[model samples]
Target chain A: MTDESMTNGTMTKSQRIGEIVETSTTGFVAVSKTLHQPPALGSLVKVQLGGEDYAYGVVAFGTTVSPDPGRRAVPRASDEVYDEAVYARQPQLTRVLHTEFSVVLVGCFEDGSIRQHLPPHPPRLHYDVHECTSDEVRRFSERLVYFRLLLDAQGQVPAEQLLAAHIRQVYRARGHDAAWLERAARQVTSLLRDDYDRMMTVLYGIEP
Target chain B: MARKRLGVVTDGAFNAGLTVRLDPGVSTEEMRIGEFVVVEGEGNRYFSLISDMQLRATDAALLADPPREASPFIAQALRGTTTYATVQVKPMLMMPRGADTDFLVDLEPPQPVRTIPMHFAELHEATESDFGAVFGHEDRTHFAMGKPLTMDIPICINLARLVERSNGVFGQSGTGKSFLVRLLLCGVIESGLAVNLVFDMHDEYAFGKESEDGVFVKGLKHLFGSKLLVYSLDEKAQARGGRGVDVTLQIGLNQIEAEDVLLLAEELNLRATAEANVGLLTDAYGADWLSRFLAMSPTDISAFCEQYGAHEGSLSALQRNLKRIERRPYVVPEAPFSVIDEMVAALDKGQHVILHFGRYDHPLDHMLVANVVTRRVRHLYREKVERYEQTQSPADKPRPLMITIEEAHKFLNPAVSRQTIFGVIARELRKYHVTLTVVDQRPSGIDSEVLSQLGTRITGKLTDERDIEAVLTGVSGRSFLRGTLESLDTREQVLLMGHAVPMPIVVQTRKYDEVFYAALGAGEKRSAQLDIVELFGE
Candidate 1:
């Protein structure tokens, strides 16, 4: 899912996740309040940029941690037996722990045309990020060529798993067209006929 | 006028051929094995045959090392990322047009894989005009044989290579070897460039036969009409009911020479002394030897042998071997007229002949007549060729003849190759404007040298590794075509390669129907199409 096609005025205030904290040629780091759930892993997200355009990336990972690891402290009250009860007593833990997610830049979309490459410039710091809407993901998948760029992405991430998850998310985003899935499978088969084992493994992973 | 790019040359050093990687979004189904493709390099178009294909993902090696068990979600995302089709091509020749004229007039020498540039130059699926330009669409050297497996265009082969050298058709039984040979003969005859002498062992070529499916198949005589004549030896009664038989062919015993007798040495099991004695008897009794010599009783033979200074065992063995010939109903002391002479005359006037074996389909009878007749035809063609070379006159030129030998291995086997007339023709008859199309199931049985000499080979499905190896002997890129050869459907799918075709191609052999006959313009309508007298207002 991607919100590249969604308008700025239409996005509800509640959809705001956080601000872009750091950026690089490959991806960006985002910091948000612990309140909102991290966008589903492998889901497309749009980071607001210096320009009017949105920089797109797949949510590779998400985590929450204390602001200062050196100043860590944990105290289990004698009467408290669960983390929920302990968190209810120590409300300041919310202020200490912050949610942050990292995303690999897959492509950029402006005027509803998807460009599967690094954006001309990184999104300006502190810009808000939003989960991609289903409409946006559907619009991006009409050609399915961006799948090439995503597959070609360089990272330590499990490419096969990431690819499968992204496809599953997009497949649902596009109304679960079995025909499209089969066509995609044919392409994969053509490329990997010799590696019968891997083809099978990859194909098995594609099944929902 | 830009043509579509089939693919681009991928990175690989080519010694005899090169591989091309399909571009993004290019489907693998668009091309087929054995179809012709061209590579653009250094301002020239280089032609090649699609030998094989290899398809695999780019990270196949990585995938091999304990792939992370990912769900279908991962598979969907990874689609088309590194997967691609690689087309392995065997380069044949380049068609070079003059830089100034932009017209390709001269044929480039067929030199393969000398220099393959690494520029990843674009390649294109060979068009109909491209195939026509290389294989020819002209009246002199063209005859449509079949259509390309992928395209709707008809395939034509070079007639010069076909008539200038011998050819072979090989396949397992019921693979339509006869149908393929019939189609090939039609092409040869339709061109009016060569005459055919088919030794029809099954009696099918003279008259149509009810196929295994009960469909009546038309023989060559039915298609070519008066141009084709059927000469039956022992099949006179049944062949007469059919329309094609022109002569009740009868071979005189005098026509069987020493060499003719030697062709049946395996069947007759002639010993060295007996075989030598048969020649001696021919020399003494002369041309009438077989009739008079075989008629001699044991008492007369012993007395004659003592007078003629011959060994009893040798003469007796010769007499015993001659007994088989006496039993054949077609053999006579002397026929009213010689069938060999009649055949030579008809061929001289550019008519084709099919010798239907009929009930005489036994190896002995078929070999004897075919051997005797073809030996005479070879001598006749040699003298004509000699005369034409000396006189330099059009009338002295001999009409090219192609002898079609069915069940070719039975006569051109390794043991008989050194002695048989068919073997001699396969070796040296091309110079005399005579060639042979040896059709057989067991290519492994044919002599290796004879097999190599065959200028073209049209092969159907063959499962035997030895037979496949024999068929692919001396064939370039044979390793690459193994799958296509072994996997061909058992019917009309045939892989035609060697000199006749521009490159190796697996064709869905053309159907023999009205459209095919009409394509030949009902046998050379070129001369009748125009008259110079009318142009002169005469």
Candidate 2:
């Protein structure tokens, strides 16, 4: 977004990428500000409730469709105008189609401390959602209690794939810390101790 | 080695021992049986031995459809979490952890484990100080036997307890049984806790013998000098070359008795009537029965049997057996001194004696001579003990004596053990100040009663199951020790158990080399200094 939003302990209007459309204690649904676009899948995103109190989640599932189920859009373009020119010709199409993503609630930041558990209350309706800064990712990944939530997610994305993606994102944001990655892998292993197939799937996905 | 962190206590029982879950960094291949380990409990520290190991996985599905071959990623990830190793620990002793551990006033000794450690107690490799605390440091009464399997510190044995009752040293052939016996004899002589009368059947104890490595090892004479005496039976065989022969032993025919013949029924191949026939001869001829019976002709034998109402066949069989003893070069008819009495006198003066069987190494010669000499010595010891008890005089009290014999099975088998002098001494439990040091290769051949009565057992490698069972006859935790005993290294390792040590331990026996010689020298100097202090009334 903007340089100001990337600074520590500060948030800016330019960094707001989505708004909450639905809310619950376990997860929430959000709509991107732009049409037919969502933040990269499995990215860390947080919603500020009030002063120094925020709720965090990881992207689990995403989709794009017309706003109304009763009305379907029919094909109106010929071979000469099938690319971006069709988007320019029918400007109203952008307003009708929207991008939506499902999030799994992992942890919360409350009273000046990062708690790796669900928030006391879900984020308010229509709150602004922003991508987590690199400092937030490093501090949150130091403890891996949130991995259990991601592994237990019952969303469209496979739980193993979602967990692996979150681990890789935090690994890169923490300057490629190999020791931290090994510890995180071991934590995952201990959690899925009885489920060897899922453990192997996650370990193979997050190699290096 | 430094005390290393091995694992934690997961589950176990008081009788079955403890189960330790190995740490992620510790591999199963690095753990070994008989290695000592320490466990930190809630309020105490436990000394345990590694008895077994196992590799386990959390899920059975992992074994059914395993990961792809050569996939290091899957193998490394599953190494410690899903699949891990566990060690079976047999906790033997426990020491309290607190201010009482200070050794200034009185050392806090390790007690037998009455309870198991708490859950998740951390286990570590035992250090040298742990060994010194459990098995005491070497001093006047405690002699250094060897070191533990993993450390270089000396594991001393309580020599005073060792001499209080009968002891055994057992192993198979070529497993250093002789070396261990020699080391023990050296300790006995140096400490002077008891006087040794060794019936050296192989002549390996008096004069130095060549070791299996082709190096010459010194015997008791080389170490004790004037304090030891060597007596040989074969004077002509003395040309083979050694030093120090204080007496050329010759047993007068009158010195031999009918009991000696009865003890050799198996070696002499006598029938069942031989015992009754020998009794008739001893009753008719009194103390000179053996010499008189050997000199009889066929007519004299028939006349004696008819007069005594004894079986003719049995009388003839007795004569045949008596001829074997008469043919021995050491046996004489009527012209020699009482060497058996002189041998007893030497033992009474606290000078150790070794009766070497120079060239007469047959079982018949060994059995007959050992039984005869030991019987006389036992009688004298019994009379002295009785006189000392009646008068309560210090001068009348006899010096403690330990009779060492090799091929112990020949003298201690179930059929003959009840009549033999060695068995009597073993059962008496130092009552008359006489005990036995039995060295044998086949312990199963010995009586189970005598085996159970042994005070301390220093055992080397034995592959036979019955032999192992016999050695561990009445010992506690026998099932655990069976595995440890069977896995001993064939060369320089032994499992020492019973009264001599605090608990059962596997030791890498100290090599009988220059290092041990130097240690012996240092021990002599220390004891000499103590003697001086006592003389000056310290």
- Which candidate comes out best when scored by lDDT? 2
Cα lDDT tens digits, model 1, B478-503, are: 78777679868898889888888867
Residue A203 local lDDT, model 2? 88
Question: Second chain only: TM-score per model?
Answer: 0.88, 0.94
lDDT (tens digit, per residue) of candidate 2 on B273-349:
88888888889999888888888998998899789998887788778877888898888886444676777777776
Backbone clashes in model 2, listed as residue pairs: none
lDDT scores for all predictions? 0.75, 0.84
Worst 10-residue lDDT window, candidate 1 chain B: B528-537
Model 2 TM-score, 2 decimals: 0.91
TM-score of chain A considered alone, across all candidate predictions: 0.79, 0.89
Give the TM-score of each candidate.
Answer: 0.77, 0.91
Model 1's chain B yields a TM-score of 0.88
Q: Give fnat of each prediction, in order.
A: 0.04, 0.81
